[model samples]
Target: MDPVVHFELPCNDRERIARFFEQAFGWEVQMLGPEMGNYVVVTTAEPSAPPPAPPHAVPGCINGGFFTKTPDMPAQFPGIVIAVQDIRASMKKVTAAGGQVLGEPMMIPTVGDYVAFLDTEGNRSSMLQPLMPQQ
Candidate 1:
């Protein structure tokens, strides 16, 4: 992939979050796995649209949903993150957009560069750039 173009949010209730996105932005999601237990890919449902269509995905647009892990299986889950091309550039925009940086940007060996930030509404999320491939 060129970069991370997708994002998913962990929710206590998949259906609720799904519905929120649906009603909020008119996103049609296809649920996978048994009884809505798998991933939900967001898509558009306009009849005039082409098949295998991609939804208008972005902030204030469509979003994915995932079931939250129980306390007993805390180790099995992780929070979702937003991908960015340049972590440093993203941090500047994030701050200018009325968000506060939670911590300094630092690199994780063999992993990526990242930093956490809180939106003006106090919602927390991280902007990250995956490590460059070795030559």
Candidate 2:
């Protein structure tokens, strides 16, 4: 089954948001630069090595990030990212299941193809097909 691997939320001040999480919950956050859309990477838990983590992160725990809120963006509310094996197939499934795919999948540099959709409940969520490690 696909698993929730990440989450995202809209924020106005990256530094302030990051500092809030760091001070309030002891979470570590890294703010990216303009080239990366000023996204904030938040680490809520230390990944427990691998293998035993079902991949790399501990079960029931996931990391999330923050993006700058903009006027033109759609579905900017809080969302989660689910890791899938085939993003194309998943997109089709989303449509067949009555969910609306926002747009075509976009490649996320080293992360693999990613896309966002609105589930039947009208909540925005995303999917990521992570890049496989090379031998």
Candidate 3:
């Protein structure tokens, strides 16, 4: 089974967007790596879910983050990526389900492997599988 682990944000001015997020939601922005063009990752320091407590404890919390991309990248590849166990199998299912592959699957360097495709509704989305080997 697969799940959505991260989401990318397509922005024209990364700094401006980062500032807006910081000021608007108190989201901590940590600029990762060198600014290679306008592509960057905007991360919220907050945890995805509140620290798990006993079953009787209070409810958990959730947060979000960003990954900047060249304006064109988003058009070519939407900012959303869903997790998958088998990329090839998923692609096949996507096609069988009336979807289409936008482009070939590509490795995302240190991040992971991803492929872009259109859902049955013709909306752009991606599927990703982590590069790390399971223990």
Off by over 4 Å in 3: 30-37, 45-79, 133-135
Clashes of each: 0, 0, 1
lDDT of 2 at 73: 80
Write model 2 residue lDDT over 1-135, tens digit each, in one string: 998999898999888989898999998888889988899988888878753333336667899999999898898999999999999999999999999999898887766898999999999999999888654
Error of 3 at 69 (Å): 6.7
Over 1-135, each residue of candidate 3 has an lDDT whose tens digit, in order, gives 565565566665668878898899776665655543435454444443345321112223322345455445534434466778888889999999998877778786665678878887667777887675434
**Candidate that scores best on lDDT:** 2
> Ranking under TM-score, best-scoring first?
2, 3, 1
Per-residue lDDT for 34-81 in model 1, tens only?
543465665533433353333322334433345544574322233345
| TM-score (all chains, Cα) for each model | 0.42, 0.91, 0.68
Question: What global local distance difference test value does model 1 have?
Answer: 0.60
Worst 10 residues of 3 by lDDT: 53-62
Which segments of model 2 are wrong by more than 4 Å?
50-56
Sorting all predicted structures by lDDT, with the top scorer first, yields: 2, 3, 1
